[model samples]
Target: MSAVLQLLVLVVLAPYLVGLMRQVRALMEGRAGAGIGQPWRDLRKLFRKEPISPDGSSWVFVAAPAVLAATTLVIAAVAPFAATVSPLDGVADLFAVVALLLLGTVALALAGLDTGTAFGGMGASREITVAALAEPTILLAGFALSARVGSTNLAAIVERGNHSPGDLLSPATLLAAVALAVVVIAEAGRLPVDNPSTHLELTMIHEAMVLEYSGRDLALVEFASALRLTVLLGLWVNLFVPWGIATSEAPLALLGGAAVFVVKVAVVGAVLAAGEVFMAKLRLFRVPELLAGSFLFGVLAVSSSFFLA
Candidate 1:
């Protein structure tokens, strides 16, 4: 109905999307996973539990969750759920969205370092390194889409992509999509990049950073991670294949738009789940090489956009 309400829907729906992904992954592996609302239950249980801070932890430890949640909620507010309209539309741009996402990332990384644990420091170092390398590709790929539309606003990108199914098939758009997809895997801690479910210290990039946080704080961080995944996937949908995104405010139009959006997200989630199940995690040292290839692809995409245009 309203932008505020739609924003709330995105927040609430993000967790379910995570659950659905888990369920799909489970089904693919022939294991029955927890129910689709498990994330909500996990959050509720965590909130009721008492937090346990490490002996050396300080205010930075306590503030990390608040900052992470606030940053994610702000990013969600600016992200268009149905179409071009967002709660923070006037202040939102594709590049600004990228920055906000990175801000949350930096805050978490700093908090990880503040804990002074070996794993925390190591994770933070790896996370920032991956981030530093991934961010340029993210911006350049987004710019490729924006370059075609002549605006950096995310909503505009979606609006234009929706009208042109062939938009993504363009050499620039395809190359950018491939690059952004790699960045998405890295940014979201998915398999073949950084495995979110890993317990091994040497392999973990995200979990190691949060190993010191417990109870509510850990829950917030995990939830934010899930939200980050949703944001990245939504961006992929909007910028690459925005077929069902609606520009109309009418009841039926919005309803149809919502239906299409759900189906599109589900399809993407299932595809990702399957990919994860079939793919092995990459060696930690080799991660940069993969990301570097993505950056090169993105560069080619932008070049194609300019020369081919």
Candidate 2:
């Protein structure tokens, strides 16, 4: 039941979260931007239109949106949302979650390359390059957390954090969180990595990959992007900082946990949006260095765990 509710919350709230982040960015810039419901309106508009496929593209091009949305939805469904022991937690370990996320990335990359456009190929190449560099950091960070709990299970990690909040303040834990904050910025198409709203071909990464998608396909891709961000952010918060998360199945606990989850994510989104306003997007060649630095942080996190323990 908790898992079911989690899934519902994921689908229903992802667009609004995107809107909220955009609104935050706008307010920070002293502009009266669109409402927090703007993304929902955009989604509705996209769904009402038709999707057009590029000529010479294969099934991968046609099905990429579905692939992206399905995999992300699965990740969100299995994530330990409000409760540590979600209905799907039995099958969701950290490795499984990471692999699923990579799967979505790979599918989109394949689709981007499948289109055979200069922009698509460029986006795919750049996206894959970042993913390759960022993969080690993500795995090492997960391992850092899992090692302390003696299990790679996300629920175990969360349960451990909830029971021992001191762990959240440890050197290893903070380093992993730092590593993941970098990872999410890259994975979720945020600035200083890739701008989520860029249209210039040279500066576009995630947006370029979806350049050929239109209408319903576009909507699915957008939703998948938003859901991926939400899920990744949720995991980051719940794993490294599990204070307000529900560790029990009690009703009051679940409700409180849900409220806390929203508050945490909103605060995170605000900080990220505000930071993007001040941070310039890194040069394409410099991206490798940033990801390398993040990977180094992950290594230090692992080393710290071993030495500190």
Quote the lDDT for 281 in model 2: 89
Predictions: Cα RMSD each:
1.5, 1.0
For model 1, residues 1-309, the per-residue Cα lDDT tens digits are 635555666677778888998998899989999978999999888888778888888898888877877877777767665656544676668778878878888998988999989999999999998999899999989888888889888887888887777877899999999999999989998989887767897799989889988888888887888777887887787778787776867767666766676677778977998889999989988999999999999999989989997
Off by over 4 Å in 1: none
lDDT per residue as tens, model 2, 209-290: 9999999999999999999998988888898778888877788887788888888887888788888899998999999999
Worst 10 residues of 2 by lDDT: 1-10
RMSD of 1: 1.5
lDDT of each: 0.83, 0.88
Candidate 2, TM-score vs. the true structure? 0.98
Deviation from native of the Cα of residue 109 in model 1, angstroms: 0.5
Compute the lDDT for candidate 1: 0.83
